[model samples]
Target: MYSRRDERNRHGRDLTFSLLTPEDAFELLAFETAERAWFEQHIEARKEQFYSSHGVSQHIIDCLALNAQGRMSPLLIRHKGVLIGRANLRDIDGENASIGYRLAACACGQGIAQKALKHLMKEARCMYGLETLTAVVSVENQASRRVLEKAGFDAVDKLPDHARVADRRLDCLVYRCVLRQEVECA
Candidate 1:
């Protein structure tokens, strides 16, 4: 379990980061439901079932299982004790992992997501021993692409028609970052 509780002050707002737990189901559900349309603009939409209590509980359970097995680090971003966003490192295989994050529309334009991402990268290096990280963003999501680039990720590839959001088919941009330089062997 990622048992650390971290507090960060951004623009006079208190931001908290921690591992997702079963206790987070209710708040997560509310956050997801409230921001579903906003999120679908850049990412795929969740099934209607995902807004339910049981569905969210199951989602939390599955994520925690992955966390315990060292395959993922699913985190919650809270502001003033409410679920404001999510940042996670997924598919942690060997020395590589992919990152994904989302923030409520109200949280946009404040650099909060970028800050949380940098913190996740720190945990990726120190706690998980990850050396490389990759991220994907919709080509239309200029905001997210900017965040990834601002955090030092380089655009490594592009996929045509990679994802569908609402009624539109969108392309995706793949980004990569090297967390550390590997030592040369004698």
Candidate 2:
């Protein structure tokens, strides 16, 4: 039931999501090493930054472990052969998809998120037959909110007291983008 055209149509244009493989460990490890050091010196001293505050948990380790086992696909963001960040197209729902990303602090403000998000969105529509994409962003994280907004996601609601950044409660913003609408507009 699948032909070359079908596969192409299902997976979308030439824009492919470069999958993360164990082979990527070297580059990922390098980025993480550099980031952890940078965080300790700069961002960590200030009220605990995003990646620094939570760091990586056993849950993430387990998830990556499962992903390495081929249970999921994680798209990596690489520039000039360097691992800059990663995003996962988790929880695909027939016509909708949810994704999460973590970028190297050094890669911030470089529009990497935008490029990654846009690529995923396009892939979701063309390949996954998805109509919408969603993401939950911490309200205090204005940079991420801006990135989503720049990618045409609309903040639909304010989830109050939904997250705890330490002892203080933090709100979360629910952002969504209609993939079909974007494609049609494009």
Candidate 3:
């Protein structure tokens, strides 16, 4: 339900976001290809990436389909028409929303994650009337946690033994960004 008009109200559209649609699948697929390759090389064998045969490619396709059905908003990160990664706002709960993202490993450390998150936050606030957004990061994923912090999400809680990663119970850190605080900053 996020709107470009809300983005205009906060700032200009260029500084905010553009919603993703099913028509953007090809570009999204490109990023997914890169991400899946990176995961297979570095994360899969280590059991860090817990994806099935459906893979990132298929998962992206599914996300796009869901977006088209108004079930989610999955935005691909693009710079000059080149896809770098993807971020999504899902698990909607009335005024609250949950977010998650993945990037090609080569694209990491470039601030794209933070940029995508900032854009999504604005969209959620304006379009969905969302007051709170949350991100769940693996306890050991310092890099992802840092990205969330950079996007103005603060560690709000910790879910102990919340996920099974690589067959081992792992903790999860919950980070939250409240729209009221962001509006105050503006």
Candidate 1 local lDDT, residue 20: 98
Worst 10 residues of 1 by lDDT: 3-12
lDDT of 2 by residue, 75-138 (tens): 8776655667777776776777787777778666656667678777877777677888888877
Model 3 segments more than 4 A misplaced: 1-18, 23-27, 37-71, 181-186
Regions of model 2 farther than 4 Å from truth:
1-17, 36-72, 166-168, 181-186
1-186 per-residue lDDT for model 3 (tens digits): 657546333332233234665465555545555466564432223232324433444665777777766557877665545565667889766688899776667556656666677777877787677889998877888888888887778998999988655556778889998876444223
Stretch of 10 with least lDDT, candidate 2: 41-50
RMSD of each: 6.5, 9.8, 7.9
lDDT of 1 by residue, 46-156 (tens): 888889999999999999999999999999998778788999999999899999999999888777888888878888888888899999888989998898898889999
- The lDDT of model 1 is 0.87
Better model by lDDT, 2 or 3? 3
Number of clashes in every candidate structure? 0, 1, 1
Task: Give TM-scores for every candidate, taking all chains together and pairing residue i with residue i.
Answer: 0.90, 0.67, 0.69
By lDDT, is 1 or 3 better?
Answer: 1
Identify the runs in model 1 with alpha carbons over 4 angstroms from their true place: 1-9, 181-186
Candidate 3 has which clashing residue pairs, if any? 2-127
lDDT of each: 0.87, 0.66, 0.67
Ranking by lDDT: 1, 3, 2
